[model samples]
Target: MTARQHDTVGELLARSHRLGADPRNTNYAGGNTSAKGLAADPVTGQDTELLWVKGSGGDLGTLTGEGLAALRLDRLRALKGVYPGVGREDEMVAAFDHCLHGKGGAAPSIDTAMHGLLDAPHVDHLHPDSGIALACAADGEKLTRDCFGDSVVWVPWRRPGFQLGLDIAAVKEDNPGAVGCVLGGHGITAWGDSSDECERNSLHIIGTAARFLAERGRPEPFGPVLEGFGPLPRQERRERAAALAPLIRGLASADRPQIGHFDDSGAVLDFLSREEHQRLAALGTSCPDHFLRTKVSPLVLDLPAAAPLEEAEARLRELHEEYREGYRAYYERHAGPDSPPMRGADPAVVLVPGVGMFSFGKDKQTARVAGEFYLNAINVMHGAEAVSSYSPIPESEKFRIEYWELEEAKLRRMPPPRPLATRVALVTGAASGIGRAIAHRLSAEGACVVVADRNTQSAEEVAAELGGPDKAVAAAVDVTSEEEIAAAFRAAALAFGGVDLVVNNAGISLSRPLLETSADDWDTQHRIMARGSFLASREGARVMKAQGLGGDIVYIASKNGVFAGPDNIAYGAAKADQAHQVRLLAAELGELGIRVNGVNPDGVVRGSGIFAGGWGAQRAAVYGVPEEKLGEFYAQRTLLKREVLPEHVANAVFALTGGDLSHTTGLHIPVDAGVPAAFLR
Candidate 1:
């Protein structure tokens, strides 16, 4: 087939990326795209029509040719005739598998049948917020007609499967001139002989619906000011989210803990501030596609102004139990005798009166996705409410889609989870520099982090930036003080059951010659670098041993510890003591399965507080170079001629804590760009 007859695979990919890249068009992997093309039949040696649909679990925004599953169009379409007699959802999935063009590939999307039924060569299906608003409106059918007239078709809500595909096909057949179709309480679909035509039609319908809503006027904008309070800073709002995360996570899981992600963006704040928020949010998802991700309704909690944290905690616990009961009741009301077992009754999304919204998941990435989807749902719901009463697919239809085996199978097909998925990590000095990088990396790898620092403000800022309280929390700890160290450990235990890994990185650098180094300076260095390491390690060990979970402890020593440097006597001596502490601690803690290690790094000057606090100028003066070139000067001194970065130190710490070093302990890994003097003997 020539380009005129069919779109190139690259064109199809481009179309999918265009639609998926915009949050206005899709959320999480909620949308799908397909293009009809010719594939040579291996046995028959003839060109046959094949439908390349977005594979299940593929995100359209980052879609590629590999993400599209190739299916024999003739075989896929023929399944409709045999589908009416099929009763089970699993059987339908197996039937689609049999129609695959290649020996192995991702399973086609559940909507493959719908795409196959369309006679057009190109089809795009999306759950855009604007389109969903119209589909979920009380007078959705009338709104569709008003928006697009005869150019688009309207199909009522039907559970997605062979029957739904047939209904959609019938609608298109009756209205051959229609370029698009709106599924009540679901999403919109557009089709044309060319990708350009399909995309243009899809965007036009979305724009029309958005304009219609705007013409009706929107609800009053919800201001940041609460009833009895002045507007709070974004930091304060993030603090509220951080304070609430542990409570919600504790309630979500009784066995394995879950992570929480916070979103207080203008859209989320505006939606939650509305007087009708609870009523509308409880009405269920704006579209059926979101049921699998966010559940039917979000759990709403009314946080009283200036209420004590203890009171808020108690209220959340009570409301969470009530939400569970409501979910169970909703399930029983809709379940038939043959319905599948319940998928736990925990709420995925929660609404707080003053704190915006929170989403829970087993990992940070999933939680963030859930947050994004809920935020998009807010737009769709608000758009519907702005025009007419927000209506969603009936509970019966939502239940079927939520419990469908095909949908659950998509989740089962996901790759196994990464290591440290449910573990908790605490990083001292995380307000900036190496500790901050380590905290970010640990959270990325699925660990809940506690960002502990004496600088409470900076610590909280880091916690807020790392997806808010669910993924991390801030704790104030003067590591030199045993009381503060113990309190920080207690906070970690309370926040995440108990810490599994502790990074002892809180210390100071004192660079002065032997004669210039005062007694006070020497004492200050040892107090923080030596005493601080001991207290943190001891507390971490006590907690991990009591919990019977083997943990890891890593100290951030320095290259100067192993190889003395002129005018760096106090810091080097203190770090050397810290290194010895690791060996001693490992020997004692090894019996409890706890491992102790250290990373010796040098020249991490970028975000390092040490360099920012006069040490950089002193070092530059000592080398007779400008302060700005100190980093470069140190880099040139290293054998590899590379600057040591905080990320490099963080990676070294991660390697020691990970499985590769399970049998290794009591070692100091150098991260000084291959400094031979600092190498371990």
Candidate 2:
């Protein structure tokens, strides 16, 4: 932790951030950066050479010192002597642990040797789209010479490993003037005596390659835009995309439920609209980093953009099956007897003619990043085909990288998924009260949440508080409006594939007796609680059915619904409607494996939105108690005498939907502490 040592690592992080900020420099978590520095050894109190490199699964853009692995440079170099050659290169990754400099901060990546063994103070191995384009081009070596004139060397296609590191080292030694090497069929690597020089070299290579492609590249490399492949109108495009998302996600999740991301960026639209796009995409991506997230290739829709909806869905199902079969065959073709079992046969990226791309992963960020990587692949294809043909590494090489033993070990080391890991939940009225608590709880349990509320600002704040768009997104929704309810469901589908959990928690109360209840009061209560719940559930059921992934719907009913509280006609009737809907829908949807349940709370006066908006004062007047003491008044009547907080109701929702109640449906759990009258008979 000396000043000098701190500055070195700090500078490395700063440099890493700069490079990662721009997608042109590298992809999300794609590249590695390193700086060799001197640090005092804990054992001998003597200066020792250390390599601070970006750790495995670390993204450069947000890298911290903790994300950098600290390794003993001398020890790392020594391992090369015993490196059991190319066939045994996989063993080298484990050996990195033995080279730790006082317990490495993070696990060393597969590309560790590329930085440690290089004859330089700083090194960067990047997967820049422009650089990869030239690397994967048919005439890449000649293009390298033509562009940089020996300042950058060309190293032929080789899987990234200890041997590739050695090969780059030797190439640097042989060409004394070389600043870097374009790794054929992979990426580019640059090194310098200083960090600044290394960064400049890396950028220079990328810029030069891009310029060369633009200057010498042919026009319309993918041929003219196909007649039926043009993009749809913006509004129509998104509408279609949203409409198809659930069905596509369902097919993709047949092996495992997947969170989804939609990208209608101009790049995706342009690529999909071209005549030669399918042929280029079939060549697959070149860099290993790209395919690891995007899969080898995308499943492109074969029909025109204007195809009939029913026909499109039918064709997509066929295409999905074909994609899976192709992927399985690819695995079988190159897998060794000892290779790890095939992970899954579903396509990670799907390209619809006019609808753009849909990428799926275990979570929102991963799915979004997967889509971004495919866009990078699209750019790489454009650049490569513009000059020579778009040629990537052989399929066998991609297969090897995809199923590498080291990668499998990395996967095995990851923590187990949370209970609601791949689930997406939409909670209406989530801006505050019980709905907000439910949203937070579901997010903590790893569900992507949509904070749907009539209050747009409050909902957005809640979504942000729950960890931004990756974890939660906000949707402006008026539960009473069927259009808004449908839009909320669409938002959930677009944000994280489709909904798996829906909470009908939105409510309003009118504590009026039959004589005092106005027609308007009764209508408003029924509209928001009873009718709103019905609309949301209907829309949710439609999406869940489309996804073919059974889901859960929980209604926040009330004790008044069963307890027949005095002077609570309008609200109680609405609650009764909700309670019955739960049983009715559960019986109907059970066939689709969709669970319907309810939670009946006596009176959540403290944090209830209904209570805060005049209901508490009105109810307090009827009970002859102060509004402040209403919670205690209700609790004293229950068996447990415990005040029900929003969190308690949220916990009840979780209990019913969080997997334990998988077999229990059409059931209502009373959350009024212990309301004897509210208990199910």
Candidate 3:
């Protein structure tokens, strides 16, 4: 597990691990786990999949840098081969050759094969005891029969190997949209694009299985309790774990990513019987969790509490062949044209028949995450079973996780926009028209927006109407003067401490004949629209750069910049320059950590100076026509029939400034209500 160093991803990974480690799960080992990064991938530039997992041997609670092993997705899929006599070692060697040639201290897990089939950025796999119990009994078939009914396809037991892989592949192939699979007399599996979802599925399955088992009543209670075996000494464990004290405290304190456990307890010891234990041991994991490790169950020796490893290994081999044969037959029956065979990825988890359990993954971190999830399920299952039995999702529902296309789609899709509780933005000329509209939109999305405009009263009025200083602040600013722009930004920063977005909406639309246009006319338009935007961009870039944060700058240009318009030379030229300045600023600020973009709109009719006031009277005077006649003139420009509003321009501006485009440095958008199309006609 290479630490994210950054707090966001690190914390997600930590939470995932803690959840997996519940003793309610078969979280001891041999599962898979993963997380999406906080920052989107720069290559695909999508804000998803910064992290992921392959749970092998370690428990999530105990995971560290050595636990997780990373691998390229493309390489993980290529391990497609079946060797009847060859063991897990040979198969793992092949996978390692391709996956970890130079990963330097990192390796892929055996479960990597199945995990590769998933598309989610975050993945976790685990097996709890109840799941295995249901998977192993003669009643196992009946259990699956009753639990899944028509929803899940119960696969007969098969030896777990390439052929078993082939069997699961068949189910997956046939379903095409299932969430996961169930081995007859075996465990269940579920998957999703995110860790929260995967863990949720794991819990849901455990609940159902626990319910089914509880119906049978407490088995006549006669297991050789391993002669009063107790949990590992907490004092000794805590003392040894002190090496991680700093990291643990930092994370567990609600400040950084925390690492701890909710799975260590006494309930697990008394809840399950030898038969239940035996059944699960024979069946393997309920699902693909504990993936290539633990051949469903572990070696169950009635030995002394502290049995040695030597005897355990001897006992482990006795159970391997049965697992193999069952896995093979499972493949023959279920695997067909529909399923993608489990091409032997690697083997980390193995059932030893009661020496507890064991599993291996590419890295220790992955092992720990799997282990933790396993334990969590186990503990939860035990408790749920104890209380009114565990009633889990039906097999059909489980199968959805077992074979979920929706989960696959979520994995493949990029991350969505985060909740907008912490964004700070400034909307220039926000007192009226489109500027005011943009400010409203930003505020609605949870951003603290500064309505910057020369109309102080109007800005204040709108801001107050929208709910005062908590969400919006009114700043009377003159875009033409650098000093004014600076003061406005300074005040906003003083209040909000920073700005992440700048929507430059301060500009004028003066219609003067080309022959009569004066230098002053052009200067007035350029100073506020072009130069004003430039000044705002410089100050924003400086703040963002110093903080090592990134921001977006949006200029509201005009559609006339893209084509010729009658009697509007000064406004057109100023808009064209404003648009050009956006690009230049984008380039300059790219290194400084800021993005610049523009929206060109020709028709924006809200409560504007022209439309809200005496627009019909003034337009009639200018055109020497009746007040009502001008409506048709404006309405005829767009093919949509609906007149364009300032809110429409605000919508486009908002989309370009947030979500993943926080990384996109330069671009221009046209929001002219199809005016350009009409112009072309």
Writing each residue's lDDT as its tens digit, candidate 2 over 1-681 gives 988899889889998999999999999998999999999999999999999999999999999999999999999999988999998998999999999999899999989999999999999999999999999999999988998998999999988889999999899999999999999988999998888999999999999999999999999888899998999999888888889999999999989999999999998999899999889888887789989988999999988898988898999999999999999999999999999999999999999988899999999999999999999999999999998988898898888999988889889998999999999999999999999999999999999999999999999999999999899999999999999998888888788889999999999988888999999999999999999999999999999999999999999998888988899999999999999999999999999999999999879877788899999999999999999999999989989889999999999999998888789999989998888878788
Model 1 TM-score on a 0 to 1 scale: 0.74
Can you give the TM-score per candidate against the true fold? 0.74, 0.99, 0.39
Tell me the TM-score of model 3: 0.39
Best by lDDT: 2
**Model 2 compared with the native: what TM-score?**
0.99
Root-mean-square deviation per candidate: 7.6, 0.9, 22.2
User: How do these models rank on TM-score, best leading?
Assistant: 2, 1, 3
lDDT of 3 by residue, 1-681 (tens): 234424534644575566556755555554456554444343575443333354344556666655655444444444554333423423443454365423423345445544554455544455566666565444455666676564445667653334444455566567655555556434565655555666676677777667766775465232334342433355432322222222111211222111122122343333232334443333333344432232233323333323454453334334344444554564455444644443332223322222222232222233334444444444434433332233333333333232233224333453543334355688888999888888888877667778888989999998897678655678889887787777676555434435668888887766667787788988887887778888887766665553345678888887777677666687778888887888888888787567888888764644565355553454445556565655555566666555667888888887886575666756777676567542422
Where does model 3 exceed 4 Å of error?
1-419, 610-632, 660-663, 677-681
Return the clash pairs for model 2, or none.
none
Better of 2 and 3 by TM-score: 2
Model 3 scores a C-alpha lDDT of 0.54
Q: 1 or 2, which is superior by lDDT?
A: 2
lDDT (CA) for every model shown? 0.80, 0.93, 0.54
